[model samples]
Target: QLRETLGIELPTNDAPPTSLETATPTQPVVPQSDHQCQSNQDQSPEPLDTSERQNSDLRAQSTEPLHTSEPQNSDLRAQSSEIIPVSSKEFMSVSSLIRGRVKLEDVNKTYQMIWTRFKEEGKTDPLTPGDMYKMGLKVTGQTGEAKLKVLRALKIVHISNKGAVKLL
Candidate 1:
C-alpha cells in the first residue's frame, strides 16, 4: 500500500539491470541539470595551473620577449645556394661515364647556387668552374681559387678516363 501510494521503487545493488522498471537494456536514464553540471565543474579543476606557474617563472627570469626576430634569424641558409639547376636529361647528356660517388643532394645544392647566381648576375653561359668554385668555396670552406683548381683537376681526370663531359 505504501509502495503503491509513493509510486517509487527502491534501488537494489543485487538486482540485475534488466529487472529495473525505469531502465531498459538499451537505454538508461541520466538526470543532468545546470546546477549539477556547475557543481561537477567546480569539483574538478583544470590541470593547467602548474603550467601557468612555470610560465610566470619563465617570464620573471627574462626581460626579452619570447618571440624575438633576432633569435629566429640565428638559423642559417643552406651551403649550396650558388649551383645551377640541371635536369637528369641535361646531366646525362653531359656524360653517362662521369659517374662518381657524388651525392645527388650535393649536386642539387650546387645546381641551385649556380642557377641563383646566374639568374642574379645575368649570365647565360655554361656554368664555369670559376662560378661554382666561388659558391662552393664559400659553402665548402675553401677559397674560390682552390675550388676552381680542384674542379680543373677533376676535369683532367674525367677527360683522361675518356668520359663524355659537359662543363656548365
Candidate 2:
C-alpha cells in the first residue's frame, strides 16, 4: 500500500530482498576507456623464466671486477701507513682527570717513558703493574699506587685482575 502511494517499486513476494553481504558483480570490472581496455587485453605479462633470465644477464654484466692502477693503490697504502702525531697535552685534556694530587703532566710523561721503553725492548707481552710503577717512578718520581689509579681513570691504560698493565 505504501509503495503504491509513493509510486516506488517494492520487492514482490516471489523474490527476496538483495542483501549487502551477498551482493557482488558477476562480470570482471574493466577501465572505462575502450582503447585502454583493448591495449591491456592485447599484452600478456612476461613469463617468470624470461624475467629471471633478464635479471641473470644484468647480474653477469655487473659481476666483472673493477679496474684500479698500481700507483693509486700505493698512494692509498702510503696514506694509511702515515702516522699522525697527537699532542700529549691535548690527549691528557681529552681524558677525564682523576682527582687526588696525581698531576696530569707526570702521568703523561710516565706513560710516554713506559711506551718508549716498551718500543725499545720490542715487548709484545703485557707489563706488570710493578714494572710500570718502577718505570713511572724513575721518570715522574710520583711514588706510590696513586699513579696507577690515574692511568686507569684516564683510560690511557688497563690493569687486568692478575695485575698486568696494558696501554689502551
Candidate 3:
C-alpha cells in the first residue's frame, strides 16, 4: 500500500504544439512613410477538437468552483460535495494553472508548478494527454469564432489541423 501510495512514479510527457505562421500578401502599392511594414502575428490559441471535448468539459466543471482566492488556512474554505480523487484534484490544479486562473505572467510558470508537484511526488511527468486540451479550452471558452480567435491568440491549437473548423 505504501508503495502504491508513495513509491510509484507518475509518467508525464511534454509535447509542445507546432506553430504555423501565416503570410499576408503584399500590396502592390507601398505607402510612403517613415514606418516599416510589419507582419501580423497570430495571437490566438488552439481550437478544441472532438478528442478534447469531454475532458475540456470535465476540467471546466471541476475548475468552476476553485477560482476563488480564499486563504487555504482559513476556516471558511469552500467544501465541495463531490468526492474527488487525487488525480482529479491534481488535474484541476494543473488545468486551473493552464487556464491562467492562477494569474501568472506566463503559462510556463504554471507548467513549472505542475512539473514540480509531480516531481515531488516521485513522478517524472504529470500532464495527461487530454488534460492539455482541456486546459486550453478552459483558457479559451467555446463561445464562438471570436472565442476560437482567443484560443488562436494563445497559440494553443493547430489551425491547419483537420479538426479545426472554418470560422467567419
Candidate 4:
C-alpha cells in the first residue's frame, strides 16, 4: 500500500527489479501531477554537486582565458603581440639563432682554411674551447664566444676536458 502511494517498489539487494519498474528501463520515472507539463520531453538534467566542483577545479587549473565561439578581437588581424606562439614556424633552432648573426657554412669554411694552415705546422691535437673562443672572437668579433656554438653546430670544432677546443 505504501509502495503504491510512492509510485515505486523499493527492491531488496538480492531481488530483481519488478515488471512495473522494468517496463520503461530506458526512461526516467517522473511523478505525474494534477497540473499539465509544459513539454513532453525532459530538458536540463538533474544538477550534480560534483559537476560544479569540476567546473571550479577546471577554472582554478587554467592560467589562460577560456575560448569563446565569437571572434573576440575587433580588428580581425593576426595577433602579433604574443611571441613564441603555439606554432612551430615561430620558433628558432640554436643553429638558426647562430645563423642570424653569422653564417655557419662560411664560418666553418674559414675555420677549415685556417685549420689546414695550422695542421701543416704540425698542430694535430684538437683545439680547446679557449682556442675556439679566440677563433670565434677573431672571426665573428663576438666577445661572448658564441661563434664557438656555430662551430660546434657545424661539427668542425670541439671542446676538450681542459676547456680547450679541437678540430674534428
In model 1, how many backbone clashes occur? 12
TM-scores for every candidate against the unseen true structure: 0.25, 0.36, 0.17, 0.31
For candidate 3, lDDT tens digit of each residue in 89-124?
333344333344333323333333333434344444
- Judged by TM-score relative to the true structure, which candidate is superior, 2 or 4? 2
Worst 10 residues of 1 by lDDT: 156-165
Q: Please name the candidate that would achieve the greatest lDDT relative to the true structure.
A: 2
lDDT of 2 by residue, 50-168 (tens): 88999988899778765745543223423543322223553454334343465656555666665565555657677775676666454223333456556565555577787676655
Which stretches in model 4 have alpha-carbon errors above 4 Å? 1-94, 104-106, 128-144, 161-163
Q: What residue pairs clash in candidate 4, if any at all?
A: 126-166, 127-165, 127-166, 128-164, 128-165, 129-164, 129-165
Local accuracy of candidate 1 as per-residue lDDT tens digits, 1-168: 766899988675986554356677788666555576565647776576888989988888766645545422112222333433434543333332333334335554543465465556766555544444555524223433232233333331121122222233
Clashes of each: 12, 0, 16, 7
Q: Residue 69: error of model 1 in Å?
A: 48
Candidate 2: 10-residue stretch with minimal lDDT: 77-86
- lDDT on C-alpha atoms for all candidate structures: 0.43, 0.56, 0.38, 0.51
The sequence of per-residue lDDT tens digits that candidate 4 reaches over residues 30-88 is 65773466564655565659989899788886757656696522222123222111112
RMSD of 2: 17.1
